[model samples]
Structures are given as C-alpha cells and as structure tokens.
Target: MRLSRAFIRAVSSPATVAWRSAQSRIFCSSPSDYRKSQPSMLKHLTSKIKATGPVSVAEYMREVLTNPVTGYYVRNNMLGPDGDFITSPEISQVFGELLGVWIISEWMAAGRPKQLQLVELGPGNGSLAADVLRVFGQLQSVLGGASVSLHLMEVSPALSDFQAQTLTGGGSQKADCEEDPVYRHGTTAAGLPVSWYRCLEDVPAGFSIFVAHEFFDSLPVHKFQRTEKGWREVLVDVDPEDSGKLRFVVSPGPTLASATLVQANERRDHIEVCAEGGVIIQQLARRILNDGGAVLIMDYGHDGTKTDTFRGFKDHQLHDVLLSPGSADLTADVDFSFLRRMAGGGVACLGPVTQGLFLKNMGIDTRMQVLLRNCHDPSTRKQLINSYDMLTNPTKMGERFLFFSLLHPSRLAAPTKPHGLKLEKRSPVLLPVAGFTDLSFS
Candidate 1:
C-alpha cells in the first residue's frame, strides 16, 4: 500500500529529527566536582572508580545506559539517521510490516488464541510497535477479532513519551502517568489498551508474543581478556595520567567468574559475556515453556564465541568507548550461544539467521515491488529502493544483524520444525515458517 504524507511524517526521516541529531547535548553536574565540564555520568563513573576501584564492563554499561539523569538512552532519541544509528524500522516501513505479518502468522499457527499479549522490549519511539499495531488493527476480521494487549517495556521517560505519542496519537501528560512510578497504562488509537513497564517482569501474566529488536545488544556484558597466567576481568578505570579521563585496565588474573571461558579462550584472546542477557532469556524461555508463546529477538551478535565487540556511538558515528562515558550509546554483540544455552531444553530456539535472509525469505522483495509500483514519485521510489538495499545489503545491516526466535513446543500440534530453525539439531521439529526458505538454522 502507498503511504500518505502523514504516514511518511510518522515514519520520519532520521536526519530531520532534532532529538536524533548529534548536535543535541545534555549538561549535568556531578557530586565530586561542581565545575567539571564532563557529563554527570562521566564524573560519576570517575568518582566510582576512584573510590570503589574499577568495575566490570557490565556494570559500566548498566550505569551509562540507565543512569537516571545523564544516561544516553534515558535522555536522548538514539534511533534514526540523526541519532547514533538507524534501526531497520526507522529505515523503512517494510521491515515493521513484514514483522507484523510474521506475528499474525505465528498467532494463526497457534490456533488463533483469543487473548494475546503483544509485547515489545526497548521500543524506540515505538515505531515498530506502532506499525505492528497498525497492521493488526487493519486485520481484525482476519484475526477473528482476537484481543491484543500491547505492552511496552521502556525505562526511558523521553522515549516512552515518544512511543505513547506515536501509538496513541497523543502525549502522555495525564495525571496517572505522573502519579504512577511503577507502571503507566494508556490506550492506542485503535482503543487497544497499552501498558508501559520499567522492566519485563512487570508485564502482566498471559500468553505473549515478545519482540525484541536490537534490545539484547544493549544489555551489559562483562569482558574477559586472556593474559599470560589466566583470563582477567576488563575494568573501566580512571586514567592515572589524566585524572579526568577514563581507560580500560585488566584486573587480577585467575578470575573465578570468568572460569567458564578458560576452555573457550586462548592466550591474548578477548571474550565477551552478557550474563544479564542469559538471565533474561532464561526468564523468557521459562515463561514460554509454562505459557504457550514465542519470543523473537533481532540483533547484531555472534553465535556465542569470544570477541571484543563492545563499542560506543555518538552523533551517528563511532566514538571511543571510554571517552565521554554516558554521553554516548554503549553496546556489544549479543552472544546467541549464551541465549541458546539459557533456553536449555524447555523451548525451541531458531536461527541466528541474517536479517537480510530472514526478511527476504519473509518476502521483502515482493513487498518492495508492491511499494515501488504504488509509489510514483521518483524521490520516494529512490528512497524506498535505497532503504531496501540498506536493510538487506550484506555490507550494511543485513549480515551484521540476526533474527532469532524462541518458540514454545506446545505452539505446534506436535514437536514440528519451524522455519530457520531447520538445521541439524537434536529436535526434529521443522515447519515452513514464512521468510525462512532454504535458510539453515545452524
């Protein structure tokens, strides 16, 4: 379908949004030094390291990302062209549309559950959720009038406001939002009740279809660098030469916490592990195992191996990890192997498939053809084409990003295989899930 000017406005160009722009700066004061020009989180980290010694990469990421006042995510629009990076949903409507379709297909495959909790994690500006809602809203009859409760897990106040505005078509200035610290509930344009939570655990109990796009990578990971004697924990410490600056330093070797990596690592090799991610996957897997549902995670990461993928971004460009602290977005590769192991034998885990292959298998090419034919404007057509290339291009987000799905075995009639998860594995469950043709789940 051809998008109107308003739809175009809704899917705004990242370059035009001021909040996404790198030029936007947030200022703050620190407890240690009132006159320090650095961001408050930066000063806070420095003081923390000075007083408590260096911290693990996971601790550093947690503080920098969600640090109430000066954290990057809490205060900024970190998506789109103007932001540190542009996610697939922001790049084109096709991405979200296909995802929405996939959700519907899964729901249908599950015998059309009367009540489904459609949940999203870290919904940036709520664009993907909004698009998903839109698609589902249009297919009410086909869905047999299934009731969907939209739940968004977003800790950032600024991003939550944007999400509410996008989904509900109104700002969240109500008395309840201000009064409720733990949770705030609203309704979308379609009258579907929307609830916001600070974390995943707060979401109400039910069979859910969870979607986490680029969310896992943001979870903090502890980095371990192998040394001569043994693996040591990588810590962020204040630079001795320059007191105000921060640098990474290795802690004492033979770290017990990193003992798991002894066999996986070699001398001088670095490995990253996101214990938080594993905990979350375990929780989600348990929920899915207990209650019939599925979890889809799309992010950039490896198949559970050793690598120093932790990095930072500022103003749509790569930035030094230890330079400005919470002023920039810090992220690392999501180790899918860790997630798989976390799932254990409770749920069925699917592909760490490339985003490009998943999307193409899901029929992005056909969707693009439809849009291109409907779109007459040369400029819009060009924009759509470029977006298609960017999303599917191997040199771009295509190969870098992965599509991982976790399904409850009960969702299918028997233990049947789902698309993308069709590689050699212990489980013989395989089905032709749309968008995963010929792709090996291994």
Candidate 2:
C-alpha cells in the first residue's frame, strides 16, 4: 500500500502537531494556530526527501518513533489512556490476573523451585507484573511461599521509573513484607543474578518462568527484498538534505548471516528478518532445555506462511514504515516458525493460538460473566463489554495477537520436539501421558 497523505503530514511535523494534539488537554489551544504550523513542516520534509534518496519504510519508522531524544516513545507518554495506544494489561485488570494464573501454573509444574525467578521483558509500567503478583498472592498457600524474585528487563530509564512506581504501589497493598516482590532491571539475561559472557549465555541455570508480551516485535529487524541476483539487507543512514534526518539504504552485506533473509530469498520481493528476536527465542529455549522452565510469548503475529510484516505505529495510528527518522514505532511481525525451529530438540512448543481463543480457553469469558453479575449500572456494563471486545475481537486485537508457550522437556511426561524441527509426531499411546495437570498450579 502507498503511504497515506495524512501519514506524510504527521511524520513531517510530528513533533509540533503530534505533541500539540497529545498535550492538548494539558494546554488548551486554538485550531487556527495548529493549521498555520503545518505547511512549513511539510515543505521542510519535502525538501529533505528530495535531497536524499527515497527513504525505506523501516528507516522512516525508526526515526519518527524511536529517535534518541525527540522520538515519540522518548518524548511522549505512549501508554495507558493518555498515550498513543493501550496494551492488554493496561486495558483491564483481568488480563494480568489471568496471565498470573498461567505463570503460577507453570511454576507449580516446575516442581515449585525454592528460589524461583519471575522475569518480564519490556515490562511497561509494570502493571502486568503487579496484577499477576496480586493473583499469585491469593494462591500462595497452595503454591507454597516460594521465594519470589522479580526481575525486569527494560531499556528505557523512563519506563524503569514507571515500573518501580507500579511495583511499589502494588507491593504495599500485599499482606506482609516477606510477600513483597524483589525488583531488578536489565535485559532478561542481564538484570537477574545470572552470569554469562554473551546474550544467550547470560541466562542463569535454574528453573525460571519467563514472560515477554509485546517485546520481540520491537527488536531491530533487517529488511530484505528478493531479486534475480540475490537478496539484499537494508540499513539506515543519515539523509544529506535534512542534517538530522535518516533514511533506509541497502547495505552490501552477506545475506547468509541472517537465516531469515536466506530463507526468504525463495519468496517474492520484500521480507523482514527478525533475527534478533529469533536469537532471543533461541536463548530462552536453550535456557529451558539446559536448566528447566517455561516461557510465555504474547504478541501480534501469524502462524501462516511467511510474508512482509514490517510496519510502524504513531499516536495509535498506522503509518508508512519509511516516514520519519527515529520518530515513530518500528516493528516487524514475529515468526513463530523461526522460534519453533530455533528451540531445537527436547522442548514442548505449544500454540500460536489466537489471543481470543487462548484467553477464552483460560476462562476470560467466565471472569467477565462474574464481573457482569455484580455490575449494576448499564453504562459500566457497556464499558466492560467494549473492553472485552477490544481484547478478543479478531478485527480488533483478539485474532491479531498470538500466544506461544515453550516448556522444559523434563516437566512434560511425553517426549516432544520443538516447533518446526521436522520431528515425526508420536502416537497418543507413545506420547508422554503426563497431562497439563501434572504440572503444579501456582
């Protein structure tokens, strides 16, 4: 699809226009002044693009959404009702509560380790963690008072502060100091008391539960397009016209370095390599295989054939991936196939399940029904329905978001191969008989 004119305008003057709209409530403004500021910005952007070669979609998105100082994520509050978009936990308490239940279940299945590590990647505002812990506290007696050590893998200091605040508030509400969760910050493998020389090596050897929601998609991705000659890797460089502008340009790099790019060459033009995300997945899988544990990956993606899934988001609206320099959100779809393959042997990989189906299977509907039973006002009831729809409606986020689970081999009674490993499916009789119930319910 071609870039929209509206997106062009937004990208060109994102700072002036987006900031004004975002902060409008804080500082009321007249429409006339806003209109006057737009043309100049467009002219500047047009001149810059002309001087520079056509920017790639990825380059445009990286600049507009993630520019070090002036990027949207850096300058704006991009979460909750006031921000550009809302995440699942931000949408409702029940979402996190349910996820907590899942984690507790996994913890129990791991034989209830004495020193259990609960880790979250890119824990925005830590709302999900707080909610999960609240539910977890309620089930502590059954799960046993397992020493809980909370670790958060976050990059942004701004987000770290927000996470600290949320954890503190939630921890205060818990019954006692012993029950209060310990908080640490760094990459999933870094922040925790784990030692490793490399990214994959950093994962501490232990029975741990890992959760990453809306995390993988944000990692840097390499874009590629197939041609008669071969596939090429995309790179970002500064645009000459606008001193501060950056644009996507092809890099003369070997495609073999990127497995996804090498595989995508057989397909049509335009593909994305989330090699970074895949590497992280492999690391997690290795951790599970070598030590023991489970990982819950939740994000928007597909379980179908491969295709170009790179895109951008600004102020809750989709925009051309190549619109601005470091000012917008740049992301590519998660390839569960790649993850499944990377997990290799001896791992039980489950579901690229639809968020709607998974949540429903996990009792979201039952929870909603319970809430509606006590809800007295019609307006409040309607609001609850809307929230549910936002979460589960296919066109909304329900079908779009996907959930995948990776479990340790020892925990599963059956012999299982990782996804995409080309292993033959065993018969029901031959398969391990340990059901999901064999795992402890935290």
Candidate 3:
C-alpha cells in the first residue's frame, strides 16, 4: 500500500510535458491522446450529480474505477514503471518470494490438505503469483505441488489478459485459455493450473490460503466530517460556481454513518468508513470459518479509522482527486480495527504489525546477504540493495505498510496460543511463529 518514495515525483511541469510529447513522437510510432480517445467521464459524472444532487464517495470510486466503458482501470496502464504506482511484487522478486515461503509454512501448519486453493485478490499482472508459484515449484519434491491450485479474483478483462500473459511466460496462445460463464482457467509457464474469478463468491468451497496485498485500500470509503451538531457524510457534487468542476459537499444533516463511529468524542473531525470493506471481510471470514484456512492482509493503514486519506495518483505523482475524475487511481488507508471487528468469533485476528518488523523478523537481511554473495553483476546487486533498503526502511514502505493475519482456530491445532494475534494476558504458553518470533502481544 505504501508507494516507493524514490519513485514518486511531483506533477510534471509544462516543460516536462513538452519533452514527453517530443519523446513520444520520436520513440513511439503511434501515440494516442488518452483523454481524447474516450468520452469525458467528467460529463457523465456531472450528469449523475445533477440528477441525484450528490453521490456518496463509495459510488464515485466504484464508478470511476470500474465503469466498464470509461473507467480508469479499463483504459489506463496502472502497474510498473509505465503506470501510476508500483506494488511490492513489482518492486522486487524477494517480496513475493518471502510471501510464497509464508504461504508454504501456513499450508504446512494447516495440515497440508490434499486439495488447497491459493487465492489472491486483485492479482495485478500476476507478478506475485508467478513468484509464489516459482517457490512452490522448487519445493514440489517435498510439498507435492500438484495438490495446489491458483485462483485469482480479478475484474478488469484487460488486466486479466496481462496476468495470463505474465503467468504463461510472457506470451500465451489464445487457444490455451478457456472461459465459461463462471470462471476462466489456464496453465502457467510451468504447467501449473490457474483460474480467474470475478469475485470471491465465485471461488468454489475449499481449504484456501488467501492473500490480499494492497487490495482493500482501493475499495471506496465514505468520508464523514464532524460539525458542532453531529457528523455529516461527505458527498461528491458538481461545483455551483464552475459547473464543469466537482467538489466535496457535506450532507444537510447527520447521516446513517454516525451510528457506527468508534471515537465519537475524539478531537479529530473526520472519519472514513468502508461499508463494502466490512461486507468483504465478512465474506472472507465466513469462507475461512466454514472451510478451514488462513488469510494474510498487507496494506498501509492505521489500526483504527482516520480521515483525509482519500487521494489519487497519476503518473507516479499525487494529484487533485477531482481534476480529472476517473483518470487517476484512488485509494485510502485500511482500518484494521474494522477488519478485526468484521472477522467475528470463529476467525482469530493476528498482528496488524508494521511490514518492516515482519520482514526483519522473517530474516530479510539474511536473505539479502545470501543473494548478494551469489550475484556477480554490479547493477543487479545495486538494484537488490536499493530494493531491500526501500522495502525495509522505516521512512519508506517498511513502517508505512502493515501486515495482518486471520486464521481459523481449528486448523492451527496448536495446544498453545496462536502466533501474532493478541492472546489472553494470563495465557502461559504462546507458540512461536516464523517471522513473528520476536513479536510480543501485551
């Protein structure tokens, strides 16, 4: 969820744009004016606002990102160097490798079911999945890799195609991919089977290992601002002075959101609540509770709800969210407290620990040193060092990003307390878990 600060740049100036235009004309044969290629989303949004008076933030985000016709995700290249932002998987293979190891360990802890489903939410370009699969392939001799299957929950068809290409060694024949009404199935480069579902509900019932890295942050959240009287739900509306412009407007009175405020008396005047996030958490909890498995959530957010975090990113730079609606990526910090509450009783919540501490305790430094020794190329070595630093540095992604775990109590089979999660104060035996060995729950 934490973007690489080094890669982040301020919005380009006029001179920079001129240089880009020249470069595009020279190096690129055909450059499409992205804005002109599609109908104006602003117009559509303005019309909606006119009809409805104002729209919820969630509605705006959902439509802006997934409008099917004019959505940002449908038209924009949203990952890697060419896109708006980069994910941890895109940063380095090491990140995904560690995650793969974690999944393997969790699988073993879950008793190594004969059939295990490895599910990833929002599998962008399938980079993480590829890396994880590589690890699984390497350990096939011991773990029986054939027992595992990869299931991805992806909505964008274009991104799905990109993921298919990446998983099948950068190029895949159209004939190899099969799609039905429910899901799409294919084989990876190493012949490992995979499937893509439109939603979590589509995945068949089974023992699952769920990974949601930077997934929940993108789900739209309702913003509420406190006034002297009470809280008012923020809404997006067309500016009165400038009809073409959009702005945030508070409701006339306190809305339904005030009922769920955790810190009503807190000095902070703003709060964000993602009802959709709650619903999805409930679904995940039910899936894992009924069918024994575990879930790993890695994102950037506070333990509780916060405010003024909803922002947009375009071309690796932060920008005015309303400037070019539906063009930039919008995301907010996840409230781990809300996730924990939605998990209910059957699922045990783990640490909402910083990603830096998790990686350090998991021996990222040791792994880096090992890789450094075998590397001959100076550039590759330098890149590795830089990525390592960026990932673990407190100022960068390390401290900003958080790691959380949810496990089914029955699957763990541990006589002692579970790892990472806060345990009863009087519990004498706390079982140590890898990567969480040093973590102490007070």
Q: How well does each candidate superpose onto the true structure, as a TM-score?
A: 0.84, 0.71, 0.83
In angstroms, the error of model 3 at 200 is 0.7
lDDT of 3 by residue, 306-404 (tens): 667888899899866766777789999998887887677778887788888777666577678778888999999999999998898999998899988
| TM-score for candidate 2, residues paired by index | 0.71
Model 1: lowest-lDDT 10 consecutive positions: 20-29
Supply candidate 1's per-residue lDDT for 125. 85
- Clash pairs of candidate 3? none
- Provide the lowest-lDDT 10-residue window in model 2: 20-29
- Number of the predicted model whose TM-score against the real structure is largest: 1
Model 3: worst 10 consecutive residues (lDDT sum): 9-18
Candidate 2's residue-wise lDDT over 260-304, tens digit each?
235642554666655556657767877788777788889977654
| Cα deviation of 181, candidate 1, in Å | 7.3
Q: Which candidate model has the greater TM-score, 1 or 3?
A: 1
The number of clashing residue pairs in each candidate reads: 8, 18, 0
